[model samples]
Structures are given as structure tokens and as C-alpha cells.
Target chain A: MQQDAARLKVTREGDIVQVEFTSRKILDEGNIAEIGDQLSVLVEAEHRPRLIISFAGVDHLSSAALGTLITINNKVKNRDGQLRLCNISPQIYEVFLITKLNTLFHIYPTVKEALESLRSGSQAGRLK
Target chain B: MKHLKLQAGPRGQRQSREKSVGLWCTEEFPSEMSEGRRVEEKILSQCRKHAYGQRDLFALKLALEEAISNAIRHGNKCTPGKNVRVKYRITRQRVDVMVEDEGHGFDPAVLPDPTADENLQRTCGRGVLLMRAYMNNVVFSPAGNSVTLTKFNESSSSSDTPLSTTTVAFG
Candidate 1:
């Protein structure tokens, strides 16, 4: 009976695409698929070599969410672009470790850091 | 070392071999991960005592969780009024995990490939592929209402027979 109480915000500044996901739980397949569809649109748009994903409001992430992230990562990589994740909670961060995905993506402590890293093409404070 | 012979039915086929684990949940979507994790832990605990080691156990655990989540969330449509049933069977050579939902069935062959270029960014539809990669035998009921996954334990006796062959098949 619990509905998806989350919303995704998409914005673009210059060549950077910023996506913010606010959700209580990112578990449902439909919701995850929707996020993927929206992300693909943003990824295909012009002038965006950088993608910033802010998970400021997400409480937990399921495997489906992780899969979506991986899928997006692949898309971004194919274009020689970057997908940077910021504001990951401790709980969700642990999930990344359990799946060994933390090592596969660019995760930063804040949006500024992610944007700066992508903009500068520097590997500073990379996620292990 | 004791075994409980459940009635000669679906439940018995999955629980007859050893100390099995069963989870019954209302068809609520949000509980999918928790239910999946519960069964995953039970399976890990049971598989650990055998010779499967960490590598095979890890793959089996992931497959089991994915299958359970699919059954509860997609198949059941999160209808809390219905029920999702999960069961596990651990023998010396193989581990069998089954997840059944209280809903009509669908065609698994029609699902989009998760690895396709268009679907790579999609969040769903990866469960079936992942299950197939990790589990040795993946069988769906004719109606598509349930999935039974079997993982062969590496340390299993070579001469052991498949449980499914010994048990009666039901639609």
C-alpha cells in the first residue's frame, strides 16, 4: 500500500545535466525503469559531457536502482562523458559496497566536488 | 540432520531434503527487498556448511534474491491482499529456490533484453538475465506464476540425482 513518494528533478546549466532523485525507497521496477528512461533522454541531449546525480533525499536503493545507475554509466561512457554521483547516504553507500559498485562509479561528497572533478578532468578524491 | 516431509505437493518438493526456510508475505511491493534478503540469508547459512565455498554461494544468493524480488514486486503487482511464497531446498549437491506469487502469469520470452542498447539504461528487466547467469537451472511454471531456480553445489556428490526428476511435476 506504500506509494512511491519520490520525485526526480532534471536541470541543465551550460553543458552539465543535473539530476536529483528524491525518494523514500528506490525499489519498484516501474519507478526504476521510469528513472532510466528519463536519464537516457538527458544523456542524449547535446552539450552535456557531465551528468551529476544528487541523492540527497533517497533513503534506500534496490538492485534495480543500482542496475539503472550501471546502465546510465554505460551510456555516459559510450559518449566519453562522465556520470558523477553526490550526496549518497551512509546506508545507500553501504549497498554500493556490498555490490562492489562503489568502485565502478564516480561518487563525490557534494555536487560541487563532482562538477569540479568532471570539469577539471581531475581524479581527486575518487571513490574506492 | 532432521528433515520434515511436507505434504506431497509444491511445498514438499522444495522442503523435503533438509532444514528448509520458507517465507510467506502479502503481495506488497515495498517488502520485496526485505523478503528477498531474508531468504538469501537463510540460503547462505545453509549453503555455507557444505563445500560450495564463497564464490558459488555468493552467486546463488544473488540469484535467489533477484528471483524473489521479481515474484513479489512484478508478478504480484504489490497487491497486499494476496500472498507471495518463497521456499528453499538444500541437498548435498544442489540448492533449489522457488518463489511463487498469487497472480496470473506472463510470457517471460517477451521481456526486453536488459543488455540491449536501448534497455541498458532501463532499471527493470535485468532480474531474469541475472538469474539465468548465476543459477544453473531456471524453470518457470507453465503459467509463469512461479520460478524455481537450481544451483549446483561444487562439492556435491557426482552421483546425486536431481530432485525434480524424483518428484511429480505440477502445472
Candidate 2:
């Protein structure tokens, strides 16, 4: 599988790009770094990057993955862009909850909601 | 005496709600991420064989990843020739894993609170927090070069409830 070397499946809806994981786990440092670099290029290309990362089928993620997301969030915010995370599994959600990252991130239950909110700058469907 | 008793049963042999010994193995691997992944798979495979629930498998996997990464990165500092030692015992009721690195250790207490408001945008310092959250118990060596993670399978036995998560540091 040529895709064994790839970690993300990225798509675009106009300026808002959607990112998905090709693997079930995000525990490796090298893979996380590559994912970070790929997303960074997308964020830099836009004046105000609108990014949605959907963790639809991901099962395991580590603190290193969290750190990379934080870095991405910072990059987006610096350009006054918006970043949305969606479809996180309940177990992975607990990781965000335990780290209190839920409060810092704009998390939605689905890509539809994240798109809706990002389009209108609405704070709807955010995790409480 | 206890060893003789544990050897008397099959895999996932149950003894009591509080504790019992099961299949175990110890091995050392070079300080590399791929080796870390190999050990993680080996341990998780045993957990699956013992019929551990998905939840327990997830927790154990996460804790193992964090602990091993810390040993390779923080403890060993990616030093050449340094090795990571892993020891694990898996039972139907619970799993205990210990990971030790060859380099000098660092104090965990002085670590900054990653969940603090000021640290919200920071990229790290959350691995230890997750290990404590998901595992029933986390104990670090006195030198802090090694950590032991314990997780009780929720589906093991109705009476074998997991104790409150706690971190014990050797003084």
C-alpha cells in the first residue's frame, strides 16, 4: 500500500479544507510531524485559513498529537483564521476533556456543523 | 508459594477481585520508535486474547504509548545505544506495565500544568496527565527514569472495580 507512508486524507471545499486520518492511531512522532507540516502548508496558503480536521475513524491519539494540534491552532489564530475539530470518538474526547483542551478548541459533533459554524462565524454545536 | 499458585491456572486465570498474576514477559529493545510500537502490539495482543474490553484496550494502548515515548524521548534523550526495557503482566482482571530508559531521569513534580490557561496554546506536557487519567495507578521510579502503569479491566469481573487513579512517586 503506497498509502502506508501517508497519514492524512485531505479535501477542500473552497477555502475551507477538510483533513481526515488514514490511520487509526496518531501515536507516532514522525507521522504527527508530517501531518503537521502538510496542514501548515495549507494554512499558509490562505489569508485566513479555515480548517476542519475530522477524527472520524481514529481510535488512539497521544499527547504528541495534541501538541501538534495546539501548534496548528496557534498558526490559524495568528492569521485570524478558524479551525474546527469534529467527529472525535468518545474515548479520544475524554483525552481532550482531561487535558481541558475542549475549552480551547472549537469542537463540533459533525463536519456539517463545523462547516455551518465556520461559514457564519457562529458558535453553534460547540462541545460544552 | 504465590508463583506456584499462579502457575496452576490457564491464561486469564482469576483469583480475587483485588489481584492475581497472569502471563508476563520482559524484553529490551533499542531506543527506537518502531521497537516501541512492536512492544505495544505484543502487549495489546495479549490483552485481546484475554478478552479485555475495547475500553480497557484503548486505555492500555494509550498509557503504553505515552510511557514508552517518554522513556525514549525525555528519559533517554534519544541517546545512541541507549535501550528501553519493558516488563508487562497481563490478566483478565488487570494489566501492569513498566517501561524504563537508560538515561538519567527527571523530576515529574516540577512539570508545569499543561491544562492551565496560560498553557492552552502550548504544544506539550500532557502525556503524564493522560497516563494518570486512563490508568488505575501510575508509579514512577525514584530517579524518574521509569514508570509503571496499571489498568484494571472494567469487563473482567463485576466485583473487580478499578481503584481511583493515583500517582505514586518514590521518595
Name the candidate that leads on DockQ: 2
Clashing pairs for model 1 are: none
Judging by lDDT against the true structure, name the best candidate. Answer: 2
Q: What does TM-score give for chain A of every model? A: 0.86, 0.90
TM-score of each: 0.52, 0.87
Instruction: Estimate, for each residue in B56-99, the C-alpha lDDT of model 2 and write its tens digit.
Output: 88888888989998998888887768999999998776789999
**Per-residue lDDT value at B145 in model 1:** 88
> Compared with the real two-chain complex, what DockQ does model 1 have?
0.15
Instruction: Please compute and give the TM-score of the first chain of candidate 1 against the native first chain.
Output: 0.86
Candidate 1 per-residue lDDT, tens place, B1-171, comes to 444434232335545343233232232233355556655677778778766765576567567767777777787776666667776667556777778887797788998865556654455666777678667889999999889888876654443433343433344
RMSD of 1: 10.6
lDDT for each of the candidates? 0.69, 0.83
* For model 1 chain A, the run of ten residues with the poorest summed lDDT: A1-10
TM-score of chain B of each: 0.70, 0.82
